[model samples]
Target chain A: MTRIGRVWRKSVDGRTAALYLLPSIILFSVFVFYPMFRTIYLSFFLTDQTGNAAIMVGFENFVYLLGSSEFQNSMKATGLFVLYTVPITIILALFFALLANEKLKGIGFFRTMYSSTMGISVAASSVIWLFMFNPSIGMFNRLLGVLNLPQIQWLLDPEWALLSVSISTIWMNIGFSFLILLGGLQNIDEHLYESSRIDGAGYFYRLRRITLPMLSPTLFFIITISLINAFQTFGQIDILTKGGPSQSTNLIVYSIYREAFINYQFGTASAQAVILFLIILIVTILQFKLGERKVHYQ
Target chain B: MKKLLTSSLFWVLILAFAVLTACTNSDSKEKNEPTKNDTSSETEGTKDDGAATGEKVSIEFWHAMSGTGQESIDAIVKGFNESQDKYEVKAEFQGSYEESLTKLRGVGGTKDAPAITQVFEVGTKYMIDSGYIEPMQKFIDEDNYDLSQLEENILNYYRVDGELYSMPFNSSTPVMIYNKDAFKEAGLDPEKAPETFAEVIDAAAKLKTDEMYGFSMLTYGWFFEQLVATQGGLYVNEDNGRSGDATESLFNGPEGLNVFRFLDTMNKAGTFGNFGTNWDDIRSAFATGKVAMYMDSSAGVAGAINNAPFEVGVAYIPHADEVQRNGVVIGGASLWMSKGIAEEEQEAAWEFMKYMTTPEVQAKWHLDTGYFAINPAAYDEQNVKDKWAEFPQFKVTVDQLQDTIPGLATQGALISVFPESRQQIVTALEELYQGKDPQEVLDKAAEGTNRAMEIANKTKQ
Candidate 1:
C-alpha cells in the first residue's frame, strides 16, 4: 500500500486513513444496518392499524407468518415468478448479446436496439404492457382474433396472470442482462477463438467449448442479480394484476407492502420481510458457492 | 510537497462535502418529508408564518385528487384564498387516496403534514383512531354551524357517536350506467333502467348480441359493500358499528350469498363480463359500447356523458328481488382537519371547508366533477338547476341518496380495518368469478375480515 494510504498506522504516522472511509461507513450503518436490525426488532411486536409498533407480541407475528396460508401462496408465487423470468431473461439476453457482438452491418444500431429497454422505468413499461394484456380490447387479443387463434385472458384469468406478468418482466430485464453479457463477451480474447477455429472447431463446437465457459462469470452475476430482482417484483404485479385474479400474482414483496402500507401491520410486514431476506440470503449463498466452482476468473 | 498534496486532498474532500451539503427544503421537500418515515401516518401542522408582521398564514392543504378533479380543487383553493386575506391555503396534490393515506401515515409526528386532507370514507375509523384529526364537530359546535343543510344520509357516513368527524366534501353513490343505443337495439325499454338483479339478468339476455355484452363491473370491493347495503344488510355486526363497536363481519349472510350468486350466474351465462377490479377499463368499455348495463360510481356519470358515443342512462344500484333497497352508501371522499395546528389555522381550514360546501362551490364541484355535492342546498342553486335541466343524469345520485332510508347499513361500516377488509372482499369476489363456490369464498373472506377487525379493536384498547 502507498505510504499515504496507510498513514493511520499507529506506529508510523499521525494522519488517519479511517477519515476517508467515514462517509461510507456512516451511510452503510444508517441505511443498511439500522433498517435490518429495526426490522428484526419490529417482528416481535404487533403493529397497530396505522403501522405503529404498538404491542410487544413476542414472536407471535413470526408465528402467524409461518402459519399463514396466504403467505405460503405468495412464496410459491414468487418461486414461480423467479423460475419464469430468470432463465428466460438469461437465455434471451445471452442470445442477443451473441448476436450484437458480431461484426455485422450497422451492428451498433442493433446493440442500441437491444439495450434500449434499459431506459424504460418499471411503471411506464408496466403500463405499456397493461394495454397489451387487457382482456377485451388488448393488442394481443386483437392479434389472436386476426390469426384465428383462441383469445387468452391475459390479466383477468388466474391461469394466465402470472405468465402475463412474467412475460413483461422478462422483456424488461433482457436489456440489462444483455448489456452485462455484451461487456463480458467483448472482454474475451479474440486469439482464443482463432486458435479454437484453427484446431478444427465448428461454430457450435467453439461456442459450447469456449464462449459458454468464458461467459460463466457474467452469467453468474446476471443470474443472481435477476434472481434477487425477480424476488422483489412489485411494480408490474401491482400495476397489471394487483396480485389479483385470486392472488395469482401476489409476490412476497407486494404482500409485504400491503401488510405494511395497506393493512398497517408493520410487525407482520417486518416478519415477512425478514423471512424473504433469509430466503434470498440462503438462495444467493448457494448460488455463490456453486458458482465459485463453475466461474472462470480469467 | 508530497505531504502538502496529501493534506490538500483531505481538505478538498471536506470542501466537496461542504458544497454538497447545500440543501433546499423547498415546499416539495416539506411535502414529501413525511413519506421518508416508516410510519405512513401524518402528523399535524407546524406553523411558519408566510409573511412577516401579521401576513396571511400560509397553511398547506393536501389532497389525493388529480386530473380534472385536481383542476377543480386548484380553482377552489384559489377562490378561497382570494375571498379572504387572513390565510393563503396552498393546495398540494399528495397522490391517490391510498397513497395520500400512506404518505400521511408516513409523516407521523412531524410538522410537515398539511393542515387539512381529503380522506376516503373507508378511512373514517382509522382516522379517528389515529387521533391526528380534529373532529369537525369540534369546530361546528364552537361556531354553532347549521348542519341541517347537508343531506342526512350523506352526513351519517361521516358521523361517529352522533357527532360529525369529517365534512363530506364531494360524495357519490353507486349508480347503474347503461348504453341507451344498445338498449334500443336490443328492443328493451331504454328509459326504464332495471332495479333488481333478476331484472338486470333479464335485460342482459335481450341486450346480448354478436359484438356487445350486456353487463360488466369490476370486482371492486366498494361495489360489494354497496350491494350488501342495497339489500338492507350491514357489512359488520353491532349495527355496522354505529350503535356499538363491531366485533365481526356479517358478509357471509344469506343476503351476501344471494349477491354472490347473482354475480356468479351472470358470469356463468357469459352475460356479465367480470372486469376484475379495473373500473377505468369498465367505464371505457361502457363508453365504447362494449358493455351495455354496468354499475359504477355516480361520479362516472359525467365521464360517461362526455365520452360515450351514444346516450347514457342512470338508475339506482340494483338490488335483489327479496331484498329491500334501503340505499347505496356514499363513495367519493371527504375533507378532514388535523389536530395540533394553530387555532387560526384550524379556523381557516374550517372556513375553507365551509366555503367548499357552500351552495355555489358545491354546484361548481358537481358540475365540473361527477362527484355529488354533500350540501343538499347545492341542488337549489340556479347553475345546478340549469345543469340538471341540461343533463338529467346528474340528479340520479342525489335522488338515489335522498330515497335511501337512513339506516346503519346504508350509512356504511365504521371499521378501522376496512381497507384490508375491502381487499379481502375483492379477493373473495375474484375467486368467486373464477368459479369457486361463492358461499365458501364469502365465509373465508368474512373470517379474515372479522379477525382483522378484532385485532384493530384490541389495538385501540
Candidate 2:
C-alpha cells in the first residue's frame, strides 16, 4: 500500500510530463483510437443504407465471416501474398543494397537507380503494371508471341492473378527495403571489416558471420514492416485485378473496402477488419518474442 | 508541486477544449458557408430581376460524367445558366457512378447534400429508399409538367410504384458491336450480325483465327443483366422487385443458365476473349481487332466507330435461341433532387431538370455524346439527323430502345442491393470463364444475391 501510494505521488509530480503528452493523446484519440473503438463497436451490428448501425446481431458478423467462402478465400490470398512477396522482396533488396554499398565508379547512380521505384506512387505503378498485364497487346503477351510461346493471362486467369499482384507488389516494395538496408549497410563499422580481412577471412565467410549479424536489426525491422504491409495491401490489388478472376487476388484489405464501401455492409467489414487487426497483432507479438532474439542491436 | 499539478491540469483542459471547439466550429462553418453565399447570390438576383421576384437559387449538381460526357454536361449547364437568370446550376464531375454514390452517402438526408445528383440506373431503388430524395413526381404534379414528353422506355426504369422517382437522363443500353471487316474476312455476312445465342456461337467459331478471338464481353454485371433482361427474365422475385420487397434472386433460372452456357461454350471452344473486368481493355481489344464481336454500351458505339480501323456494326444484344428478344433495360444514370434542401433549391433543381429535357439541349447532348436523348423529340432536330445520316449506327441504338417491350423485365429490377448483387454476378462470370459448371456458378451467384437481399430487408428501418 505504501509503494502504491508512493507511485501515485510520483505520477502526480510528473504532471508536467502529462501536459507535454496531452497534444498527442488528443490527436490520437480523435483520429486513431476513436475510430478503432468505433469499428469494434460497429462490428457487432448491421448497418442500414445510410451506414448507421440499425440491427444488433452480436458476434453474427464475425461468425458469418468465419463460415464465408469469400472471406476464407481472402485469408488464403493474403497469406499466399505475404509468402510470395516478403522473402523475395527482402533477399532481392538485400542483394541490391549490398552491391550498391560497395565503393565503385558511379555507385551513387546505382544507389539512386536501385531506390527509384520508391519515388513512384503505388497507384501509378499499379497502372503501369495493369497495362503490361493486358492479355491482348501487353508487353508480356507480345514478347511471348514473338517467342512463339503460348501467352499467359497475366491478370485474367484465376491461377495467375494473385501471383501477378504479388509480383507487382514486390517490385513496388523493393526500393524502400533496399534504401533502408543500404543505410544499415553503410552504418556498419569499417574497422570490423578490416579486422576480419586481416584475419584472412574470405568475403562469403565474413558476409555470413559479420555482415548478416550486423544487419540483423535492420533485417528484423524490414521483415516486421513488410509482413504488416503485405497484409494491408489495397492499391495494387484494386488497380491490377480488382479481386477478380474468381476472387483470386481478393486480399483482406481490398475485401474490407468492398464490404464497407461498395456493399455498405459495415458490420461484416468491421468484423473482417477486427480479425485482420488481431492477426497482425499476434504476428507482430510473435515476431518480437521469437525473432527479436536473433536481432543484433549493435 | 501541488500548485504546479493543479495549474497544469487546468492548462491541459483548456488546450483540449480549444482543439475540440476548433474542429466543430470549422465543420459548422463549412456547412453554413454555402447557404450564406447562396442567400447573398439570391438577393443580388432579386435586385437584377426587379419585378420578376424570382430569388436566384443556386443548386449544386453532382454528376459522374467524364471525358466527352463531362464536356457536354458543362456546355448544357452553361446554356441553362445563360437561358434563365433565376436558377444557377453548377455541374460538378464527381468521379464514377459508384464513387459519386459513395460520396453522396456521407451527406445524404442532410442539408449538406447536393440539390441534384445523377445516380446510375442500378441505384434507382437505393435512391428511392434512401430517404434523401424528393420524388420527381411531386415536382411534376406541382408544376403540372408533361412527363409524357420523355421516352417511356427510359422513364419506365425510373418510375416506381407508378410514380416517377427521378428524372431520367443520359440513358443507354447494351449493343453487340462487331468488326465488319473481321466479319467479311471470316466469310460471314458483314451487315447481318448474329442475333441469337446459337448463331453467335456459330459465328464466333468461324470468326476465330490466329490473331483474334471471335467474341468477347467486358465481364461486367450490367452486360449480364441486359442479357438476362432480353430473355424476359426477372432478376429477382416479386415482379422484378417492382411490386414489393424482393426476397429472392430469380436470375438463376433457365434464362440465366442459358446465358452462362452460351459464354461457357464459347470459352471452351477457345473463341471467347477474356479481357478481365476493365471496359477499356475489352474495348481496346475490339478496336485492335483482337476480338471480332463484343458487348458494349450503346453510348460506346460512336467511339468504336471512330477508333476502330475496321467498319463497326451495332446490333441488338443477343438473346437465347428459344426466347424472343424482350429488349434491354436502361443502363445509364438519372438526375435526382434532394428532399432536405430548401424548397427554392428544389425548385431550382426542377427547373434545371426541365431545361435538360428540352429538345435543343437533349439534341446537343446526344450529338456530343452517344447517350440517347431522354426526350425522343431530340431525334427530330437537324443536327442529330445530320449526324445520323453520316453514321447510321446511332439509329440502331435508338431503334432498339424504341422497340423495347414495356414489361417488368425491361423496366429493370428494383433492389437497394443491386451493386452487391452485380458483384456476385461478376464473380460468377469470372468463375464460368475458369471452366466452372455454368449452373453451379449461376446458382452460387443467385445465392449470394439472395443473402444480400435478405440482409437488406432485415436491416431496413
Candidate 3:
C-alpha cells in the first residue's frame, strides 16, 4: 500500500509539472517554433502573388541564391556589419561600464546618461539619425562646412553608407550593453579589490588580475547577445538606406524583407531566412564551444 | 529545506517564462478579440435596428490615403452617406499603398474582405491576376455608367483589353519642377523650361552654382518609367505586355540607354545631385536651393509652390534629344470592388465609386489634394478654375496629361511583377549614379527582371 501510494504521488507530480508547462509550450509553438518550421518548409517551394506555396521547386531557390551576385553581396554586407558593430559595441560598453563603476559623486547620473539610449526605440533613433545623415540640411554637413572640410554624402554615397549605418548601430547598441556590463561590474566581490589594494597593487594590476577574470562570465554573455543582435539588425538599415546606393547597405535580413514583402518572392526569401538561421546557429555553437572555456563563472 | 528551495526556484523560473510569453501573446489576442466582438455586436445591433426600420447596407472601404487625402475622402463618404438613406460606406485609412495591399492579401477572395479597396496604379496587373477583385466593368455594364466623362489619358492606363478593371480615382504624372530664381540667375528663361534632353543638359550646366547642383531626380523607379515612356519606349515586349504576356524586358534597349546616358552626362559633369530614394529628401533639397531643378510628381507641385521661397516652375518631363515627347503615364491609385462580398455590398461600393466621380466631389478632391481630378469636367468647376488661376503651376500638370499621346508605352506595362521590375530599375539607376557603364547596369537590371518574371510565370496556377 505504501509503495502504491508513493508511485501515485510521483505520477501526480509529473502530471502537475506538464500542466504548469502547458502555457509556455503553447506560446513557444505559436510564436517561435511554428514560424521557424514554416520558414524551412517554404524554402522548398515557389509562392504565387498571394504568397501561397504554388509549386514545389525543390532546392532551386537555394541553388539560385548561392549563385546569385545580389545574395552574395548581401552575405558580405551582413558579415561586414556584424564585424563592424559587435566588437566596437562591446568595447565601448565595457569602457563606459568601467568608468561608471567607480565610487564617486554623480556617478549615478553618468550611469543613467550612458544607458539612456536603451529607452529609445530603434525606429525613432533611426529617423533621428536619418535627418542627421541627410546631405544638404544635416548637422554633420554643416559641421563639415564650418571646419572647412569637404562634405560627405553620409547615407547617399555607396562608399560611406554601410559604414554610416554601422556607426549608428554601434551607438544604438552601446546603452543596453553598458547597462548589462555595469550590473556585472557592480556584482564583483569588494574583498578581492580590497585585498589587491592591501598587497600594494595598483588599479590596472587589480583590473588585469581580479576584475577581468571575475567579470568573464558577464562579458561572455554580453558578447553572445550583442553578436546575435548585430546579426539580426534590420530597422536602422530599413529606415536609413532601404538597402540602396548600389545595394551597398543591403544586409541579409533587409534583403530577406525586400524579397518577401516588397517583391513578394516568399520562396527565395525563405531560402535566405533559412541560410541566415544556419549562419546564426553555427556562430552560436562555435561561440559556446570556443568562448565558454575562457569564461570563469564564480 | 535546500531541496524545497531548489524546487521553488524552478517553479519561479517556469512561471516567469509563462508570464513573458503570455505578455507577448496577450497583445495580439487583445487586438483580435475586440475587433471580433465589435463586429458581432455591431451586426446584431444593426440587425435589431433593421427589424424596426428599413435596412441600411453598411460596407467597408479600405483606402491608402492619409493626411489631406484622408480628410477629403472622409468628407466625401460623409456626404454620400447623407445623400442616400439606404447604404452606409465606412472608409478606413490603411497605411501606404504597399502596406494596404499587403493587408488586403490576407482577407482577399474571402467574405471578410472589404467591399472596396484603393490599389496603386502599378498594382493593376497584380490585382487583376490575383482573382480577388470584381472588375469595375461589371458594375459599369450593369448600371450603364458613363466612362466617356472620365479623363481619357488616365483611362488609357487602367483599361486592359478595352475593359476597365478599376475606377480611376487619384491620378498623377511626373513633371519637371525648377526654381525660377536659379534659372534667371543662370541667364536661362524661367518661363520656357527645357523641352528636350540636350536642352535640359545645357540649362543644367548653366544653372550649376557653387552651392547648388544643376539638376536632380529622385532615385525612384516611377520617374525612370516616366522617362522611358515619354520617349515612346516600351518597358516590356509584346506591346508593353498589353497584347500578350511579356516575356522580356525592353527597358535595356536604346530608349532606356538614352535616359541613362543623359543622367550619366550630368553625373559626370558634376551637375547632377543624387538625393537618394526618399521624396521628402529630394523635395527638401529643392526647397533649400541645394539643387536648381528636379523632377517632381504633379501631385507635389502645389506643395512645392506653396513651400518654396523662390518662384517654382512646372513643365513636362523632358524627352530624349532626338525623339518627340510622348508625355507621361498616369500614376496613383484607383478604387476596386471585391468579388467575394454580398451583391448588395458590391452595389453599395459601386454607388460610392460613382459618387466619388461626380464633378463636385472631384473638384473638392483636386483642390484639397494635389492628385488630378479623374472627371475632366471637374476642371470647369468654379472652385478648380479659381484655384488654378491662383496657382498656375497646377495648370502645367493638367496640360501635360491632356497632351499625352495614347499608346502602349504610355498606357504602362501590364506585368504582375511590376514592383520587382521597378526594384531592379531602382538598383540600376543607383548603379548608374555610381559611375558604372550605362549598358552594363541596365542589362543587369533587365536580367534581374527577367528572372523575377520567369519565376512568377512558372509559379502561376
DockQ top scorer: 3
Compose the digit string of candidate 1's lDDT tens values, residues A177-273. Answer: 9999999999899999999878989999988989989888778767877877788777788789888889889998889877777888778888888
lDDT by residue for model 3 over A174-256, one digit each (tens)? 99999999999999999989988999999899889988999987887788778767767788988999998889999888898
1 or 2, which is superior by lDDT?
2
Model 1 chain B scores worst on lDDT over the 10 consecutive residues at B18-27
Runs in model 2 lying further than 4 Å from the true structure: A1-10, B1-55
Task: List TM-score (chain A only) for every prediction.
Answer: 0.94, 0.97, 0.95
DockQ, in order, for the candidates? 0.32, 0.33, 0.46
Question: By TM-score, how accurate is candidate 3?
Answer: 0.93
TM-scores for all candidates? 0.91, 0.93, 0.93
Per-residue lDDT tens digits for candidate 3, residues B1-461, read 63464345434433433333223212211211112224445456567756663567889988889888999998999999778767888888777788788888989999999999999998998899999999999889989998999999999999999999999999999999999999999999999999899998999999998899999999998998999999999999989988887889999999999999999999999999999999989999999999999999988998899889999999889999788889899999999889898998998899999999999999999998889999989999999999988989999899999999999889998888888888898899999998999999999999999988888888887
All candidates' lDDT scores? 0.82, 0.88, 0.88
Model 3 / residue A234 / CA error / Å: 0.9
Which pairs clash inside model 3? none
Compared with the real two-chain complex, what DockQ does model 2 have? 0.33
**Where does candidate 1 stray beyond 4 Å?**
A1-20, B1-53, B108-110
| lDDT of each residue in A1-298, candidate 2, tens digit only | 6998988888985887889989998986886567777889999999888888999999999999999999999999999999999999999999999999999999999999999999999989999998898887799999999999999999998899899888999999999999999999999999999999999999999999999999997897788778877888888888898888899999888898888778889889889888987787687767776887787766
